[model samples]
Target chain A: DQQVKQNSPSLSVQEGRISILNCDYTNSMFDYFLWYKKYPAEGPTFLISISSIKDKNEDGRFTVFLNKSAKHLSLHIVPSQPGDSAVYFCAYRGSTLGRLYFGRGTQLTVWP
Target chain B: EAGVVQSPRYKIIEKKQPVAFWCNPISGHNTLYWYRQNLGQGPELLIRYENEEAVDDSQLPKDRFSAERLKGVDSTLKIQPAELGDSAVYLCASRLTGVADTQYFGPGTRLTVL
Candidate 1:
């Protein structure tokens, strides 16, 4: 049973364009959500996150939107750069506290 | 500060062999977790420890998988008589004890069973 899902396996966009990655979850108990970026042969690094209480959170060029009613969230990278090319995983922290449920991940490629 | 550290970046072994992966969490971190990630899939939590105590291990396959955190700072995961289906990446992550604290992940150990 996959609690979190990222239907899109890959995405392509031109540099300086907008890149959006979507994620959905089944469990409503999840209160906090985060996005992690991973490179080849490296561990995932924290990108951005949004709490269920808020609808949107923004950090510079990266923004995360949370729709609690739909159990969905999305990461938006404005003016995407070639350096942004990597696998992005969306994770959720439920009421369980320390554990995180991760999605399959989406590979985003930005072409210059 | 340094991130989580894991050894044996890659390992290849035949079926029925025993293998082990080790992880060292970040300094001052109290929560450590072990995960298994299959190809084209997300990482699945195998076990989680708070200090020296395992808080959650429901997903662990106890029959063949075993784990330990002796000093509450480092951890080890072992697979006995590994099967071909055991080919996957083993990841270890750590975080400070709190709500919504970010988890720092290790480079991961890739295991291939022939």
Candidate 2:
């Protein structure tokens, strides 16, 4: 069974607009959540993260919100640029072994 | 600092062949991880190492897959008698001591078993 899920397969947004990606988890053992962005034929790069203690975390134009009760989280990018176009994946840090359970991932396209 | 490096960015071999991919992590980083990613899927950890010791490898297919991390800096993943279903991207990542929770990923080695 997949512990983390990203229902959206793809999303398109205009440059300079807000882009929101959503993720859900079925495991309560997760205490840390991270977002990674990946380009074609490359490895994933860390974007932002949020701990279970906080409901929100922001860095520059990127912000992540987590609702523990809902078992849901979202990543928001304001003034999204073409460079932000890539595949976004959500991962949960397991309390045991510190392993990460990743979602299927969402492909985002920011049209210039 | 230079990022994680992986060699043989792309490889194609017929089924039942043995293939190996190499990786060099960032300087001074002691933790290494190997992950597999399929099309439209996220990365799945196959093995994890802490300073040359494999701390976790429960997800690895022992019958045909094996990995090694020597000197605690570089790693190799090999698949013997690869099957057509083994086609996927093998990604390598590394981090510092007690910092393996957050990783820096390599470009990955794409493998296609015909």
Candidate 2's C-alpha runs over 4 A off are: none
Q: Write the per-residue lDDT of candidate 1 for residues B1-114, one digit (tens) a residue.
A: 898999999999999999999999999999999999899888888999999999999999999999999989899999998999999999999998875478999999999999
DockQ of 2: 0.84
CA shift at A77, candidate 2, in angstroms?
0.3
Model 1 regions lying over 4 Å from their true place: none
lDDT of 2 by residue, A7-43 (tens): 9999999999999999999977688999999999889
List of clashing residue pairs for candidate 1: none
In model 1, what is the error at residue B9, expressed in angstroms? 0.4
Model 1 docking grade: high
TM-score of each: 0.97, 0.98
Worst 10 residues of 1 chain A by lDDT: A92-101
Q: Write the per-residue lDDT of candidate 2 for residues B16-100, one digit (tens) a residue.
A: 9999999999999888889999877899999999889999899999999999887877899999989999999999998886754
